[model samples]
Structure formats: structure tokens, C-alpha cells
Target: MPMSEQRYLVAARKYRPQLFRELVAQEHVTETLKNALRLDRIGHAYLFSGPRGVGKTTAARLLAKAINCQTPLDQREDGAEPCRRCEACLAFEEGRSLNVLEIDAASNNRVEDVRELRETVRIPPQGARKKVYIIDEVHMLSNAAFNALLKTLEEPPPHVLFIFATTEPHKVLPTILSRCQRFDFRRIPVENIVARLREVCAAEGVEADDESLMLLARKGDGALRDALSAFDQAVSLCGTRLRYAELAQALGVVDIDLYFQVTEHVRTGNGAGMLQLVERVVGAGYDLQEFVIGLAEHVRNLLVARTLPDLSLIEAGEATRRRYAQVAEAFTEADLLRMLGLLAEAETALKQSAHPRLRLELTLLRLASLPHAVDLRRVLEQLDRLAQSAPEAPAAASSSAAADPSRGRTAGLSRLSTPTGSTTPQPAAPGSNLGSGPFGPPALQVRPSEKPGDSLAQATQSAAALMVAEAPEASFETLVSRWADVVQQIKQVRIHVGLLLEESRPLRLMHDTLELAVPGEHAERLLRNQETFLITQLHAHLSEAISIRRIRFVVQDRSVAATSAALPEEPEDPLELLRRLQQQVPALQQLIDRFGCEPLWQGN
Candidate 1:
């Protein structure tokens, strides 16, 4: 092959898209541009803005060629494409077209440059019908220069066109932006870039695996030009026989295995393996921050793979994608989210840290040690299922859960207290058990009649029920008739409360409030101590029985009448009570004699 026939072209330039239809990942811009050209509704100025290497300037060039191509078919239905064989297209491709000019705004951003441009715009294209000027990084233009060109850009000669391209569109003057039809270019997807790379490789007769191509695509960070450049470097390093290992090593990239190993270490709780992986990466001389970034990406891949159905969003080979999906199953979406968060924090901190390697190691350790964030809703659902299957024994389950090793602290998802949204505790239902379990109280027995060794809760519930039924409101006389029954019921429910009640004389009944005359302050104190509980029981007894919603207990000072009514005819000494108990209950006398018990407390 002759030198003229066989030419050398780098991947970036050799494969650059020349037509509106050929530009990658810019359909919105291309479709609109083609429609505008087809409709002959061309604007005087157009703005193309996006991140670097995402076809901004390229789209501008293609637009210029599409409009300037001389072939009659070029402007037909199969239009918006440059006839590359035409003089206009040929000259434009060679960068020698007098009809089109590309100015680097970073270098020529002064007011004088704008003046020169204005002067040039006045002259028609020497070869083509219209002249187009492409200003790259137009945001670099000085304010004065932007102002100088604003009028010309807004209403240029009919034969002139201006195209502005910028990564930072916000920095461009609002006046200039208003004068142009702006098009935003998006970052090309990694899959698209990889597909393009595969085409390039086949055309070049080079052998590259999917993993190698995937890695190259991700290295581009959504920039096809950058991905091509990286691909070119890979080709240069290994001369087209592209093995993933050599390509990765030549680029000094952390191998995918390291990230995989890091995740595996996290799954298995192996901090040491992660540390060794770091050592291997450091020994290879890769940047720790870069490693952290890659780890974050790895976690991101897992997250998307786990949570989303579209595997195309993940940039990896089929095998790698399968592995990601598999590992993703081991991790919940919440776990992957937590992992990404930790890695991102580490990556950010590494930028500000004095010791990046140590920070990275700490991050790795943290990730490896992260207790998987389990979804509490799912855990609760499982617990509910278990509860239903076994028996309705929350009390026993709760007690057992307190002592059960399996119930202690679950890994991955630790216990978290959630708001039950209830203000007061609800008592157990009539026949249901409270907290009965192997570790809790026995099943609550709803006996028809009271039996020996019944739980206090059951007995209290029974007494409360009986009190509700029998303690009805009546006139003072009827109420006084039931006072002894109230005392007896209280004695059965609680001996101490009943004893305190025994020291009060019913003075008067005023509505639901029971005004009691107490013999002394000692009895009054006891009543006040159990006031809330006593009132609940009293209201339960009195409420529906009377029309009372609440019942109040009031104790007044002992008058002679109250003292006389409340005081039982008895021995004045405490010893007299002991003597009475000894006489009434021989078992109490026997226990007292056996222990040789002495009176520790004496009443006045």
C-alpha cells in the first residue's frame, strides 16, 4: 500500500462522527438541528453546552457542514447530512474552509478579537452561501468581548452564522445566551461507548475482550472522546493484542478484582483481606483516593444491579454483571446504600486528609465492619409471621426474646425502636394472656370461679369486673348500705388499701365525689399514695353504675363524729393487735414463737 493510500489515524479522530446522524448520545440536539435545517428555520447564532468531550464542538462542525454542503441531494429528504465529496465538505474536513472558522475563545477572548470577528462577519463566505463561526469554550470570552459581539450575534448578516460551545454555560453572558438557540449535550452512556469501541476494534482488526472494553468505557466517565483516547493509549501500550490484565496494569488502574475482593471481604466480615487488598493496590502504586472512588463505583454497581431490573445501567462485562447480580443478592439494597455512603465519605475525606492511605484503610475497615442495614419493615414482618405460626404468646416471646441467644442482637439488622404511636399502655383483653411465654408468666387462665395460686393480674381483673358490676351509685342511704360491701371488696382486692379504707367514715356523697372523714393524717396519706389506682377502681365501679364519668376521693380532718364512727372499739396498744392475731390465727402464733419475733414498729 502506498503512503497516500495507507494513512494513520488515531481512534478519536479516525472515528469522529461527521454527520448529524453520526453524533453519539446527542439525539435531542441532532434531531432538533436536523429539523431546523430541514425547515429552513436557521438561527443566526446557536449555543452548544455540556461537559468537556461530549460532542459540543463536533456537533457545531457537523451543523456547519450540513448547512453548507453544495450537493442538491444533501438538502433533500435524506437531508441534514453533508455530502463529504463536495468542495464545502472537503474543505471543512481539511480545516481549510474559508466559509467556516473555529476560534478558541480561551486564547482570543479580548474585545479586539470580537471586533475582528465582527469585521469578518461583514464579508460573505468566499466559497459557500453561508459562513459559520464556531467559538469553543465561549464562556472564556471576556465580558467586554461578549458585549462587543452581542449585537452582531443577535442580528448578523443573513449569510453569517455563529456557534458557541462551552462546558460552563452559566458563566456565559445572559445577553449572549438569549441571542442564540441553545442545545445541551448529555454524557454518552458507557454501553454506547463500549459498543463504539467494539466497532473500532473490529475495523482495526484488534482483539479485545468485553471486560477490557467495559473498563475503558467507564474510564471515560461518559465521554466518548476520552474513552477513545484511553483506548488509543491501551492500543499503544500493547499494540492491539488487548488483554484486560495488561491494559489495566498499563493504565495503573485498580483491577476489578480488588473491588470484588473488597466487597467479598465486607460480606464475610474479613477486614484483614480488605487490608491486604489495599496493600496490593498501594504496592502497585495506585492512588488511594482513586481506589476509594473505584470502590464507590463498585458499590454503586451492586446497588443498581440489586435494586433495578436494567442491567444495562451497570458498566461491566456479562460475567462481571452476573457476578455483580449474584453478590447483590447477598446484599440488600439498604446494605448497598450504606456501603456506598461509607465509601463516598471516605473518598471525600481522603481529599482533605493528611494521611490518605490511613483514611482509606479506615474506610475499608469501616465498610468491612458495617453491619448490613436490614430493612426494619421486613424484619418486623418476619417476626410477625413467626409470632402467628407459633402461638399468641407475646409476653412469653418477649421474655424469651430477652434471654434467647437468637433473639439477643441480630447481625446485619439490629433492633431499632419505632414509634408505636400510642400514648398509654393498653391492658390485655378479657380472656387473652398478657405476656405469657416460656420466659414469661403462664397462659392466663380465665376460670369461672377463683382458684388457688391464680395470678395477681387475673385476680385484680376479676375484682375490677365484680366492682364494676356491684358498686352502683345510690342515694346517701343506699350508698351507706353498700359501704361495708365496698370495704370487703377492697380487702379482697388489696389488703393494705382495704385497711386504709377501714379508717375512714363515709361523711357525705356529693355527686360522684366521695368526701370521706379520716380519723388521722396517717390514714389520709395512705389514701393519697394510692389515689390514682384507687380512683380508677372506684370510677370503674361507680361510672356506669351511676352516670359518673369520674369519681373523686376527698379526705377531711377527723371530727368527733368521724373519730367516733371510724374508731373500732379495741385495745389502744399495738400489742393488743398482735394478741388478737395470735388468738385468731394459731399459725401466725407458731411462726412468731418459732422466730422469737419482736415488734419492730409501734403505733402511737
Candidate 2:
């Protein structure tokens, strides 16, 4: 706390690895070097490669001391161990080892430095086993320096060992790499980093919680020293125990609970709630990028928890993991995937964007409103629900086919077409009982969308409705395709609708008739709502003289969801499903007339 002691000691250096055993997440490098020393298979030159703060330089020094220790152990022969008590070890610890020469290749990267190094390697050791040269950041050495060092590296004296360490090993000459025994190091995993941080904290006598420790470990990003430095700051900032708020404020990280609340709101299709939460988060003055990263991570957790179902493997703490599990339970797998994709895209936007706040808010808004989007699954689920809840309106069915003149049913009402030239057939719902009991045979023949008794005049009315919904477009094909794309966009926000939409395929592109076939009648109602608006928009967007005369909703007899539950439960959004059906099938002019039942398909 004194003025002199107040000088900043970056987290990186304060916890720099001083001993081989102190190194984190580079056991392969350390163990291999220790083995070489123990086995006397020490190569003339060694290459240590990995990311920064991952012990490349530290490993180099440790190798140097082990090789040239004054009282070098037979440990490599015994078991790859270093003798810490020897004079050479003592000298190396003091940075005054006679035989161990450490060079920063960055500053001294000229040919002259290589020349001097070459001369030094030839003299052999005055007091150690070998004249060991340690070059840190050898990638920074000049081309000439590399070439000058190559020859000696190829055939150094038996008593000389060259150890080169580099964060960017690719920058080091290939010739240099090939000549040495390469040992690759990797960035420590978060778990390893946390363990190391705990060790450091214990040594420093700082009391810390798992959450705060995990935060520090994440901040380290595999760097033990960085985590320790952050730990030091956290300890200083909040004394012994670190509060989540203090950790967030000190680290510029958003509160985990904010992320929890926001993601929870998103799961339930609460756009207003999400917006309110976002306003609060932004008002807290948190960096938008940080929040974006956290949101992406939060979504990712939900995704993994939903799919994997193994909380132990996840990288969050118990509290965070529980929160993720709860959120994951609320969402379907597809929902989480869509949100994750959105968050990821938003992360990119945040990075490239100058206005992070705007990007963040927009991303949050997109996620919050995603449930309103149409998805194939949602559409399918809606169809299933409609089949379950809708009663057998036998008279309504007979009247429906009898009323539309341009429509007719064939093959026992398997297929139906309206008088407007729509040939889509409405299929029976998966578990809908056509007979006496649930899932029984067809007791009352489910009539098609078009009636056999529909006179020409009545057919004209049905056709007129279809034409009114269809707007003028340049090409019916383009209109329908673009409509499908919009439905797909809707699906991006609504997974259930997206699924059902995927099932409803377009059959025919008539002049004023768009023929679409769905798996069942439930899909018919789904296509009815946006049926008119989409037709209008299609005409407007393409500017063609194509009218969406009718969305022919024909059902396929086979139930896609039959393999699972007996009855399909209603999805959250049914209107989107109807739009999907209409977009997928333009010929089914009477989707609303057929499956537009109450409770399931809310008329929009």
C-alpha cells in the first residue's frame, strides 16, 4: 500500500512461472523436457511452440537449468526430474547461470547477434554439462540471424544445447523448426486455469468464491499469470471476498443474472420484458460487446444443456448451470439453436459496428421477437393441435364440399379442389377419429375444402376471395418462392411454425391459384391467416399480375407426428403456421374454411 509498492505489477508478471512445476497446462512440454534430461536423449536444439502466456519461455529456462545443473541429477535416467538444490540451479534461479545463456531474440535479432551466439556455442561450458542457449521469441529474429544459427543448430557440439521458444512458431524459419525437437504447447483449458488460479489465491491467502474464481479464469483465457493478476486486483478491490457486482464492475463484465433474466424472457416470447431488461442493462453503463459475448455464451449454454443434458461437462458454475438448465427446459432445442445463431451474428455485428449499443439492442430485440417468427415444426405442431381439439363437424364438412362449385373431392375425399381451380386436398389429422373412438376409422367422411354441390356462382365467390388475397406479381413462381422465403424468415423466429412449414410443400403454381398440400387439416388453418396478406405482399414485391386465387390446403393421410405422441399438442403460434401453409400451397383456396377452428387457430 506504500507509494513505492503502489507501482503497477501487471497480472502477467506478478505470477510468471519461476519453477517447472509452477507451469500450468503445458505438462506435455515440461514432462518431455524433464524426460530428455533424465534419459540423456537431450537433442542439440529444441523448439517450444504455443500461444503467449502458455509457458514457452519458462519451459525453455527450465530445460536450460536441468541440462546444465552443476550437480545434475541422474533423474532423467531415474525419472525425468530436476535437482533444485544444485549450484547451476541456484545460478539459473538468480539469472546468473554461467553455462545457461538466455537471449531475447526480439531486440537482438540482427546477424551480429547470431554470429555472437555461434561463437558462444563453440566455446562449450566453463562449469556445466553444456553451453545451453535460450532464445525467447526466436520468431522475431532476422532472416540472416536464423540462417546463421541454422548450421550450428544442425550440428552443435555435444556439450551445447539450443532451446528456442516462440509464441508465433510459424514465423520461425521452417529450416530452424525441422532441425530441432519440437514440443507443442496448448492454451490451458478453463478448468485447468481455474485450478491454477485457486492455487495462486491460496498461496496469496486471498479468500475467493467459485463464481469469482471462474470469472478470473475466463478472463485469463488459459493464461495462469493473467488470472492471478486479475485475482490480485479483485482481492485489492473487494478485500477478501469478491462480490459478483464488484467483479462485474472491476472486470467490466455484465451481471450473470441480467443475462439469465434476458434469456429467460426471450425463451417465453416476452419482447417487452426483453426490451425493458436491455434498457436497464444499458443504463448500467456496461460495454455492449461484453454483454453481447455474455448473451452468446448464455444462449450457447442453453443449447448445450438442452442437447447434451450433462451439466458437469458445461463450463459454468452450479448456479449458472442451474439457471441454464431452467432456461433450457423452457425452450425447445430448435429455439436455442436459432437464438444462438442470432447472438453469434450479433457478436459479429457488434465487432464491426461503431455503435455497439444499437447493435446490442437490435440483437436483443431480434431474439425477443423470435417466437413470433414462423417455423416448420411450429406449423406442424399447430396442425396437430387443431386435429385434436376440433370436433367432427360432419354437416359442416358435407356443406363445405357442397358449397364450392369450382371444387370437387375424389378418391373417398382424399383429394379436394375449389371451384377457383385449387386442387389441394385436406388430409385427416394424425389422431383424429374418423370413426367411433379416438383414432378410430373414418366414421364420418372428412369432406374436402371444395364441395360437390358448389354451383358455378358459388364457386366464383370462393375464387373471388382467393383472387382478393393474391396480389399482382410479375411471376407467380417468384411470388410463391419469395413468399416461402418470408415464411422461412418467420420460421427463423418461430421454430414450431418453421417445422410445419417445412412439411407443407408447394404443388402447383396456377395463374390465380396456388396449390399447396399439408400433412393434415391442422395445417390448413395455419395457412389461412397470412394467406391473404402474403398474396398481397407477393404481388407488391414482384409487381406481377399474379393473383393468389386460393391457398389449396390438402392433407396427406400419413401423420408425420404419429410415431411419437398419439395426439399433437398445440404449438405457441398457430397463425404463422397458417401463413406457411398458404405460402407452401397456393391452390388450396379454402384453408380457413376447412380447418379454421376456434382455440387452436386464432383468427388474425
Candidate 3:
């Protein structure tokens, strides 16, 4: 039966490294072992740990042969590579070496196996300088077996050596590790794996592209053997011309180009674009989980590239690497971190979800919309534009403050954006120990109520008792101005609140009564929800029983600009409200001109 059928040799079996020099990406482990053998400073037990199929067992076997090489390098008396023609090397390779023992601990993990092994260690080697027992999957041994083997491992004979190889080193007992010299093998890098695979393909006369080799290398997860196995599959599926599409389809993996396109959508905050991309991907029959994993990896690469461009260690083809370099330069570090976090979270959600496609689509939408909504850069840019158009005169800016109750005066108010977008330091409130005096936010002044002047006094005292009133002189305008300031503070707290502030425009104040206008009937209902809190904040700011009333909003269309005449009126220019204020209160006129307060002028 065997003679008639053809035997297909797997790439893993055919390309296994037979000697130290042939091992790829593991020179450190081999060179160190060679040096130890040459110096004759070898330990009784040696532990080799690393990812699967990355030469742990192979290195263990090599060590055994090198120790017993008769015609060794002998620079200091021993050699680098074992002499294959030596009695021990030939006997070892033939599976008939008396002193070289290989045990698969995975299947033989019991106290009885350990007891039998303990007994075998008592006998000496017949032909070699040292008796070597190599145990693979040492981590799989039972706790009882480990305990039973512990004493012999700690104090074995000088002529005996124990080699333990495991994919998981932490699972092995610490007591056993203390008695051995340890070597941890790393996952081979993508470039190194691809190069090795290329050599194997050429030797086998298989034609494959660099892209296909990269996909195989990535699929291997750092194991050379796994990469070779994937290579064999690619050879059968595509017959040596490895195209990226065919390779990914064959292996159930996503292509790199898709990742690049998805990242561009995220950077632009295009939700529709992201959803379209997801629909196309799903329609193409790619697995949602596979796409999620690939997307997460792509974000991770971008983050690495953004944070450490010089130190980024990627294993992609030249074209793909250059594309990554361009993407890295385009995104900021903050954007990358946020994207990575979002994608990682999405990956977990995608796994648990029954409708993974829907979840993926939602995740993409979230990523795409983030750039437009809460980005710090966008907020700062808006504020910068406002600042540029702001008037140079402190008075015009100050009047701008008094004109809009939603923009108030506070010590830190300068850091905030004005309605027009400029940032300017605001006057301190009156009685504010904040180092700026009366021109500051007007002290909690109470507007006099007509109910015998004592009623306003009683209300002011009550407000002060409530800790809302600061001790400041009273005036009707001061109370109105301060209440306006509190409204502005709340506006700054949230944009929705700020929009509400615009809708609730201040109308006028008369005899301890304050009135505001709500833009629409719907807005009036919304304002009612927060009426109680709003009144309390106003009382704290006004220190008076200033009632708030909301009326229908009215539109006022003026031919002349509302802010046109802030300066004193001349004969040629109509003498507006500013001239009138100057006529009635000459002292106020000095204050207005001195502080550069733009005067209100009467239009002809």
C-alpha cells in the first residue's frame, strides 16, 4: 500500500533545522551554549523556553550532540559545532545513542514516569562523556511528578545532564528552575521568517511573492515551523505565484490594504464612509472576528509608529512599510492612542456579539465620528478664530461682556472663549477678594423692591444667609449685571446650556423684576425644567428677590449697528445714549471715556 501512493512531505518536516548554524533568528541561544561547552562550565540541568516550533527542542538536541563531539572545535579544548562524523554524533542522529535520552513529557506526565526517570539517572553512560536526558513539555508534568523529580534535579551526578524544553516556562516549578541554567528563545521576527521561507521555497522550486511570504510569516505567530506549514498550504493553493488576495482567502486572514483605507476614514471622522467600508467588507465574505483582529493590529502599529517612529519595528513588505510610515506622520499621538483603545474595546465586543457585523459597523461609526466631535485641536481652533476678530479696546470687549449675560467676569474667565470667539481677561466681580475691585463682577447687589424698601433688605439678608450673596454695595444695574454673569458661567459649563442661554435672552429689569425671552414654545418648556436651579443661582449672584419671567422672543431689526456708537456723540455724528448718559451723569462720562467703554449712541 505504501509503495503505490505518493508521500507528500510537509514543509515543517522538510525544512527543520538540523544544525546550530542552520537555526534562524536564535544565534544567542546557540552561541551561548557553544561557549559554555567549550569552557567546560556546563550546568547539570539546562532549561530552554520559548514559543512553539522556534527551535527549543532542536537547540536541546544540538547541545547534547555538541557535549559528546569527539573532534570538537577544541579552541579551549571543546568546539562550536559538533563533529557529525564522531561516534556520539552519528549514534545520536540514528536514534541509537546510549547516553542521549529524549522524553515527551506531554503523554508521560505522572509520578510513575518521574520515579522511572529517577531510576534511569542512577545508571551511567556507556560511551559518552556525559549522560543527557532531554524532556520536552516539562510544563505538562504533574505537580507530584515535579516534586518527585526535584531532589535528583537539584543534586544530579557530575556525569549526568538534564535538558528541559517548554513553551511555557512559568508553569514549571521554581525549585527546579533554580537548579538549571535557563535560555529563553524569542519569536522570530517577520522579516527573518520571510527570508527563511523564501530560501525554503526556492529549494523546493515553489514560486511565491514577497507579499505571500509576509502573510505566512504573520500567520506563524513567530514560529518558523508554523510559517513553513503555511507556506506549504500556499504552494498547494496558488501553485507558487503568491498573490495577496489568494493568500488571505486561503488562510482566512484580512488583507493589509483594507486596514489602510479604514484608518483614513477614522482620521476624517466620516461615519457614512466607515459604514460603507464595513458593508463592503462583510459582503466580501470576510469574518468579522478576523477583521476586528486585523483592525486592532493596524491601530497598534499606527500607535507605535506615531510614538516611536525611529524605534518602530514592523515586519511588512517595503511598499506596505512606506504606507505605514506615511500614516504615522499624518496622525497625532493622542489620536493614535484613542483609536487603539477604541479598536481594542471593539474587538472584545465583536467576540461576544451574535451580530458581529452590526457591532463592527457601530464601532467604525464611533471611530469616524470622534475626530469631528470632541477633538481638542478643533475646540482650540474655534477659540483662536474668535480671539482674532475681537476688538482691541478693552471697553468694547468689556461692553461685549455686559451686553451678553452669558459671558461673565471671573478670575479665570480670561481663559474662556467670548461669544465672538476671542479670549480676553474679564473684570473681577464687585466685593471679590479676587484682587480686582468694584468694576469687577458687581457684588451681590440687590435691586430695591417697591414693597417698602425693607423687603429687598430682608431678601438680601436671606440670600447672604444662603451663602449666595457676597458683601457688596447695592444698585439695580449691579444686580442685573451680576445675574447675567451667572447665566454665562452656566453656559460655559455645557454647549447645550450655552444654546439655552442664547434662547433665554435678557429683556429688561424693572422694580426688582427681571424678564427673559425664550425663543420658541418648545424652548420655554425645556427652560421650565431647570427654572428652580436657575433662580437659586441668580439669587446668589443678585442677592435680591429679582423674579425671572420668560416671554415670547421678539426679533428687532435695526438699520444701524447696535454696537456702532460706543464713543461720545459729536454734532456731525448723532449724540446717542452715551451723550445722554454724559449729560445726566458727568462722573459716569469720565469713567466711560477713561476705561474706553464704548458708549451707546442714538441713531438719527
**1-604 in candidate 2: lDDT tens per residue?**
8897786766566677766777887777777776666667888888888876778877887777767665536443345445677777788777777887788988999999888877777786877788878888889998988898878889888888888888888898889889988988898888998787777777667777888888888888777667777787788788877766788688777878887888766755467787788788878888787788877887777778888868876676788788777767767676778887888888788888988777777877777766322232332343344335444424544576677655422211222223336544343333233222212332223346644444322333322222223222234445456767755665556444555566677776644567767766566676666577546544554554455656666777344335324534655356665565454443332334445643245354
Clashes of each: 3, 65, 16
**Candidate 1 overall Cα lDDT vs. reference?**
0.74
Candidate 3 lDDT over residue span 133-209, tens digit each: 99999999999999999999999988899999999999999988998999999999988898998898889887777
Better of 1 and 3 by lDDT: 1
TM-scores, all models, native as reference? 0.63, 0.64, 0.62
lDDT of 3 at 20: 84
Ranked by TM-score, top first: 2, 1, 3
What local lDDT score does residue 145 receive in model 3, on the 0 to 100 scale? 93
Could you say which candidate leads in lDDT? 1
The list of candidate 3 runs beyond 4 A from truth reads: 1-8, 75-78, 267-269, 305-312, 328-330, 373-604
Worst 10 residues of 3 by lDDT: 434-443
Question: In model 3, what is the error at residue 528, expressed in angstroms?
Answer: 43
